[model samples]
Target: MADALITLEAVSKRFGTVEAVRASSFSIADGEFFTMLGPSGCGKTTTLRMIAGFELPSGGRILLRGEDVTEVPPNRRPVNMVFQHYALFPHMSVLDNVAFGLKLKKVPKQERRRRALEMLEVVALDGLEQRKPQQLSGGQQQRVALARALINNPAALLLDEPLGALDVKLRRALQLELKRVQSETGTTFVYVTHDQEEALAMSDRIAVMNHGVVDQIGTPREIYEHPTTPFVADFVGSLNALEVVIDEVVGDSVVCRFGEVGRVVAPAPHGASSGSTWRIAVRPERVTIGTEQVAFDGGSRLSGTLQQVVYLGMLTQYHVDTPAGRVVSHRMNDEAGLSLETGAEVHVGWAADHTSVLGPASS
Candidate 1:
């Protein structure tokens, strides 16, 4: 926190009857790839706009490197924003587009051109400096926009769904390129996106927002492996959520009543008590296929009827209807899995460590 380059202290933004962003407080470290990730209308883009000084918070403060800039105008803030549109001048050459901000600053023409060319090389657009925005590919134009933003040398770069306009393959390619450029430049990046995979792939830390509030913030691995809330568990990846009642606590685990799932073992989280109800979450990859007579190694097991099997080359997804509930299992598509099909009776088991237990889902 001491090294945070940007900090939001109880920031709130409202428009008439609706609050677009609640009192969100978080910090992005110096040279960190921090992301605000959520679904559409979750205020992620609004938060980015606020950081870039495009939206003024109705309450609280916005800090940049320990200085309060809560009331700073967009032009005065030490930040720049790149949007999905890439907003390049249609008639200007690529170099001029990248150097437009410098020209406005009255920076010497030669120096501005040098910096613009350097940034273009950084973004792998060296050969297209003379081309117009319409002359280059979508990805190239995006790189030009990134070059334009970075050339200003802002304290932080705010990106609002910058890859949203590109096709899937181009988006994926540019995600890596952006990551590489960030690493090379060591500039603080606060990116906004609704795509979970994009956030997980690019961010050093991610703040997961929902309904105008941050549900959780953590590294991708931490969020995926140890989600503390049901929304985070369900949003960050595909997983099964089951309603169960705690039967008892044994050693370091809890025995849960899964109705027809029989007695099941789950990791005992704090605040859990015997006879209490909870939501059980497990990833499809964590559930293993087992036989009726086979005993699993310290985990929950259930019997089910295979309802569907989808073979996706690398992995196979099995939809099973168990007495307790329907669950999905993901297994590597190896030679042995070739025989699996719908209508077959199967046993599924998941390790307690791989399970996440949360409060009951809201009504």
Candidate 2:
């Protein structure tokens, strides 16, 4: 954070009686693609607005490149915003939409046109500069919107779910395109999105927010593999949560018992003690499902009846019913275990290191 570009210090926002965002604090390094990810009404959008100077914080300060800009207006700040909808001028061509900002600044018409064309090329829409917004595809129009926002050379670009409107395939394509643009321009991007896949695919770092609280912030792998909270573990990916009672605490690990026939040795959470109930979670991909029992060194095992097999193009999921409730395991379409039929007895196993202790079980 020595070269922090955007910093939020105890920033919170309240809409009259409703607290939209709690005291949230984080730093975005220069040229980093930082994402605020959560479900709707989680205060992610409100937090983005506060950073963009559209909504002033009810508490704390926002700094851009070490300068306090909490009270700065949106237009005066060296930042630009792109919304879910591409707010393009219906009457103007794509080129004109891009050059609109430069025109407002009263730059020479020739210079503005030259820069607009260059920006179009950067977004891979150079040949369609003369087309109207309505004439282009959803993905193309989004690129135009991106080109328009980045054309101004803002120190940081704030995108509020810019890809939310596109179709699934198109959205997936643009996720990579957006990251490419951000990297090529070397502009710090403050992106907001509710899609877990989108956030994981494009972010250098992510802040997982829930009910106005910042639950965890980390890289995609860190957040997915080592979630510190139940919300993050359940929200970031498909998880199998099992409630268990601690039987013993052995050094750095805890032996927990679940249901009538399941026992697991998982890494102990802070302050873990015997007789305390806790929840442990494992990702679906980490669990292995098989008809025969397999010995796993330092791992946990469960016996269950295969309930269902879900085939999702490149991957498949096996849902098994065990004494501890239902557990799921994921495997690529080509992997073994796909031949197991539903209603057959199966063994589910995962390495102990892949399990995460999610504090305590909720009452």
Candidate 3:
């Protein structure tokens, strides 16, 4: 925790009557790839802008490396940003664009050129220094933008949806490139994006934000596997949420008494109370859609009518309607799944370990 390079204590941002970011508290360690991930209007970009000195928090202090930098100007802060649009000057060549920051700082002509070329080479954009932004491809232009930002050697790099403009294949490629850049330089990166896949693929730690508040912050595995809230469980991946009332608490496990679905057993989340309304969340991959009932006791099972079947090449998804209403389950395209068909009666069951008891479904 002492290695936290950026610390936000009780940070809040408001625009008139609308609250953009709540009193959020979190920290980013030195050299860590931290991401602020959420949907549009979730205040993820707002948080990044605050840290980059583009916007000041309405309240709370912002600290960098144990120093209060709340009042620091954007240029004075030890940080640089790569904008979503690349923000490069079309008139300038790649070399001049990369060296623009150094020129602003009054770096010597020779040294600035040397550093700019070194950065261009680092980003694999060598030999294209003479080309203007309009002359370069989208990916090439992005690399130039990165080189320009990194040439300054800031303590941390802030990226605001840097890959939003690229195509799918190009975005995937740049995700790898960005990860490689972060690893090679070992510079702390604070990236903001609404893409969950990008965050899962690139970030060392992700802060899932919603309604201007940090919903959850953890490693990719932790965020994907042990989600603390239904929003997180549903947002991170495909989930089958079933509403059930809790019947009894047996040690660490809870027996949920579903209306027409019958008894189900699953691990209880912390602070779950007996006889309370809870939801059983199971991933699509964990659900098994079988024509007949599988002999698995001490587990949860539901019988439903298979309504539709979607062929996804590697896997087939079956939509079923049970007493708990409509639910979707995933199955591989193997022998066990070859006979799956719509309008067939099937039994969907999951092991206790695979089902998570998320208390109370959101309205």
Candidate 4:
């Protein structure tokens, strides 16, 4: 897009014998909250570092606000970063820590303090500016880190797992807080994390990465509901898989014979061939289980033995053994006023449209 605030064009990075990032190309639109998400060693952090100018790309270019910044040093780029560890100086008070970057750039003493205090207020740390890092709690230190980064008022802010250090409750709180701050500033944010829920919760769009390459890039809803690949389907949420033998291709739909589960119809995945073996995938929440036969609106249904039942406060999850092997089904605690029990004979079903046919699993 023309309004992209940051563009990475065919960028690749190598370290000695290993390639840390492949030919990656993506654009973060102006004032958008974009995230890079993947498991460890998936090149998410390397991609962020290249954009930050901490690590140079071996090929292609990096552009910021329509200007080529591939050759620019870290300090020269119009960007600031909040590190995973906060990277706050323990010896310095919050004010000094936030003002350090401005001072390094030769900002005037009085102006730096003014900007620092303003950002501290922006991050809700106005009164605690004189406290050292050790004197503050984990969440407080994170806010200070954010204050320091935002004090520069850069075109974009880069966060590398910024909430990874806090406890679960605090991390959740900061996630929302960070989102609010980003909206209030209207500054583009490029966040990196391995947590799928965090990405889905906070990102306007997410680039799912694997094996040093971007596997898919889309809105959180697109990545979740219509995953383009098996990796994306497996990575983005809980999945249930069924092995099936493809019978034929009927237009854009594929007819498949699921083992011990009978025939099912699913939309053929792009590039799939007729009569080829495939794996059918469905999300756990998409499956419905009941002691009686349930109407199939658009999904395939089958009978399974309830092997285990786990009762969470909001929902009940059942581990079912079916002809297609083990399947996990989740039902809302109040859905149909039904309560599932172990050893129950239940029929499981889902809309056919929810089914995804994938490449046959490797033996």
Q: Provide the overall lDDT of each model, using Cα atoms, as 2-decimal numbers.
A: 0.88, 0.92, 0.87, 0.87
- How do the residues 15-131 of candidate 4 rate in per-residue lDDT, one tens digit apiece? 998998999999999999999999999999999999999999999899998899998999889998889898889999999999998999899999999999988888888999889
Candidate 2 structure quality by residue, lDDT tens digits, 1-363: 789999999999999999999999999999999999999999999999999998989999999989999999999899999999989999999999999999999999999999999999999998998999999999999999999999999999999999988899999999999999999999999999999999999999999999998999999999999999989998998999988888988889888665565667799888889999899999999998887774688678888899899989998899999776789999888885358888999988889899998888888
Roughly what TM-score does model 4 have, to 2 decimal places? 0.92
* TM accuracy, model 2: 0.95
Maximum-TM-score candidate: 2
* Best prediction by lDDT: 2
Residue pairs in clash, model 1: none
Q: Give the root-mean-square deviation of each candidate in angstroms.
A: 1.9, 1.8, 2.3, 2.2
What TM-score against the true fold does each predicted structure earn? 0.95, 0.95, 0.92, 0.92
- Residue-wise lDDT of candidate 3 within 1-363, one digit each (tens)? 889999999999999999999999999999999999888999999999999999999999999999999889998899999999998999898999999999999999999999998998888888999988999889888889888889888899999998899899999999999999889989899999988899999999999999999999999888887777877887887888878767788888888754655456789767777767777788888777688874457787778899999999998899999776677888888745358778998888777888876667555
Give the per-residue lDDT digits (tens) of candidate 1, residues 307-349: 9989899998999887668889998977373466789988888
Candidate 1 wrongly placed segments (more than 4 Å): 257-263, 292-296, 335-338, 361-363
- How far off is residue 307 in model 3, in Å? 1.4
Error of 2 at 37 (Å): 0.9
After best superposition, candidate 3 residue 180: deviation in angstroms?
A: 0.8
Q: For every model in order, what is the number of clashing pairs?
A: 0, 0, 0, 5
